[model samples]
Target: MQVQKTTIPHWSEDDRPREKMMLKGRNSLSDAELIAILIGTGSGMKSAVDLGREVLLLTNGDLYEFGKLRLSQLCEIKGIGKSKAVSILAALELGRRRKEIQTEKRPKIDSSEKAFKELRGYFTDLSHEEFFVMYLNRANELIQVKQLSIGGISGTYVDPKIVFKYGIDVGACGIILAHNHPSGNLKPSESDEKITKRILQFGDLIEMPVLDHLIVTDNGYFSFSDQELL
Candidate 1:
């Protein structure tokens, strides 16, 4: 009988992801290279690069889309079990926070256009629905932007009571409501109008006032207040 030889994985080399990153100066790397730096290693049949490629494909080229996926969804990829999925998500979130910290230097919101432009980078690529409350001072200076809820496109279930809590907590004198249409239309649905009416009604009671309700699509937005609807 002939003896069979087993092949060793190059990814097992001590200086793989880190060494490649240092040698290439980061910008020269592919998506798989950057992701492999975060993911560390792979299993028998798949290399770390292969696992990262699958992740990108599964997410349709948007890394933020991975945040919308369930752990079960990620585990369906051959080499990415729950732990690896968590690790990737955690690293991505950290990157988001770091980027946000750097964004603090950008000009703050003064007009509805400024507000939408500020929010577009975050909401543009979301796979699921999300609602945001952009708190503003009396002069329309940006105070804080809150993530009110993450739910289905039909609704995000904004409560007048909880919305008020965030307003009071942030000491906002006024607020602008904004949510994205994944369908890429700026038209406000019945649910969007309903939620806007309810929030405005509560703002009436609190004296904080609703500045606007902005329905954002990928390409543009409709402003309820600007249109004299709010």
Candidate 2:
């Protein structure tokens, strides 16, 4: 039998991902550089880096929402074949798994960041307004998350009575309110503030405190509690 040698992977003439990772360290590599390493090569006039940048641009550079992408959606990108798409998705899946392993059994909402993480999934990528309420126990451990209403791109109606009903039904001690701004603006509109006060007032009357109100956008979240608006 003839001897055979193993193959290796690199990115471009300089193999920037590999070289930069080796010289500086893996942490020094940008998201594009890391993605290029997995994709392996260029297509047409685009380099691996260019392809990586395109993918990031599609997601607006947030890796947390990367899991929402489907194989078909990824393949729609120019020059990204099924193989390359799978490669990217597989890597993302692994990252999700690792995070899941490290995640707490019952996610405790001790801070705005945790609250945002708990509810962002529901609102991300929504093209219209949708209201969600997360019921939490006394210790702030999530009891349940629910969608209360859906509205057009403009706004959603959040009935404080209906919200109180959900919390009462779940025997929740506190509640977190969230709604998406499909326009990618995190600022709380006048309507947003008014609703928060209404819900907060009713929540106090019922003894189910409103801990936080989050306005989710494509880029990030605006937290009422964090801003002392709650």
Candidate 3:
């Protein structure tokens, strides 16, 4: 059987991808339009937009996750040959590099909320236990937020040493330890008590105060310090 050709129209002032981009702005473009701008054209049967849609759906709407796929996997798309696959991958890498460069000039950790905002988006649907350490400066401004452990909803392991080492290494004057229960219970548990006591003791030795131990859930929060445990 012979393959039939599908033709794209000649570039025109009103319809050209670059002109449309300049007139409407990048943000105004649909996902397919944005991808078509990158890919330039379609193959025998499909438009670049249709090809890009297939790629996105295969990766569950995350382009970064799609980039993790092998080049052979990308080339499996009917219209995406090895060169086109490489172009897509190169575009992804350029985006990744640009983001890294923009964020690397200075690392800012302003507050516990700001430091942990990344976690909020990612953890909204988690079904297991998770823990985080928030390192703070003398003024209680955040320096870093680290995930120390993740376990089943009722169980987790967190090393006081690992948590404190970051504090000591960063010369943090204080720390706010926090974690979430997927069950939405902000109340501290026996294990939570044990870990808090151990971490507080470690902090005391180095003169780095553990300002507050907070158990925050999607529903609300509970503070051991607020309860006079600190």
TM-score of each: 0.75, 0.59, 0.56
Task: Measure candidate 3: CA RMSD.
Answer: 6.2
Regions of model 1 farther than 4 Å from truth: 1-15, 59-70, 99-107, 121-128, 183-185, 201-206
Superposed Cα deviation of residue 106, candidate 2 (Å): 1.7
Q: For residues 40-60, what per-residue lDDT tens digits would candidate 1 score against the true structure?
A: 777666667778888888878
- Residue-by-residue lDDT tens digits, candidate 3, 1-230: 98755434554555555677799787766776677767777886776767777777777777545656668888887888888888877886776555323243333444444444533433444568778887777766556667788989776788988988888888788888888887887778898999999999998998987877777666656777778887
Clashing pairs in 1: none
Stretches of candidate 2 off by over 4 Å are 1-104
lDDT tens per residue, model 2, 1-230: 96443122333434577777888888988898898888887687677878888888878988766666888988888989999999998987676555433245678888889988877667654679999998999989988888899999989998999998988898899999999998888999999999999999998898999999989986889999989987
198 in model 2: Cα distance from truth in Å? 0.7
lDDT of 3 at 1: 94
* Backbone atom clashes (below 3 Å) for every candidate: 0, 0, 0
Q: What is the lDDT of candidate 2?
A: 0.83
